[model samples]
Target: MNIEWSALGSVIIWGILIGAGLPALFALGVKTLAVPAGPDGERHPSLGRRVGAWTCFGVIILAIVGAVAFIASGGH
Candidate 1:
């Protein structure tokens, strides 16, 4: 049997990077937007946190859209 070691390594590396990286980024956004409860049980995320979360979410959405487009276009 013949095996393409380089191709296999590349797929493994990229699979881990993208598979883990996107979720890690989304988790970071969730952490950024989280607020601890105050004495009055109120929580408010800062504007920066809101923006960061939205930006992270936007990137995820964009990636999904691009993937769908690529599949629809025959992944050329």
Candidate 2:
């Protein structure tokens, strides 16, 4: 069969975005959640940390959506 470049491009782009974006987002989140110790030597996640975690969770949701779409697209 003849090769299809546009389909290949779509698959490649989606794979790259999903593969790289998710991990980068998660790492950024983990870094933010890592709170430095105060004089009490206790670390706590601030509101920003919670929000970042939620944002990463949202990214995970988006990734799952993308996966569903990709599979439905029949890329394989």
Q: TM-scores across all candidates? A: 0.79, 0.67
Instruction: State the displacement of the C-alpha of residue 70, model 1, in Å, after optimal TM-score superposition.
Output: 2.2
In terms of lDDT, the poorest run of 10 residues in model 2 is 14-23
lDDT of 2 by residue, 8-76 (tens): 999899878878878888888888888897788887889988898889978888878887998999974
Task: Quote the positional error of residue 46 for candidate 2 in Å.
Answer: 1.1
Backbone clashes in model 1, listed as residue pairs = none
1-76, model 1: which lDDT tens digit per residue? 9899999999899988878878988998889878996789886888888999989988888878988999999966
Error of 1 at 72 (Å): 1.4
Best by lDDT: 1
Candidate 1 whole-model C-alpha lDDT, 0 to 1: 0.87
RMSD each, Å: 2.3, 3.3
Clashes in predicted model 2: 0
User: Could you tell me how far off, in angstroms, the CA of residue 26 lies in candidate 1 after the best superposition?
Assistant: 0.7
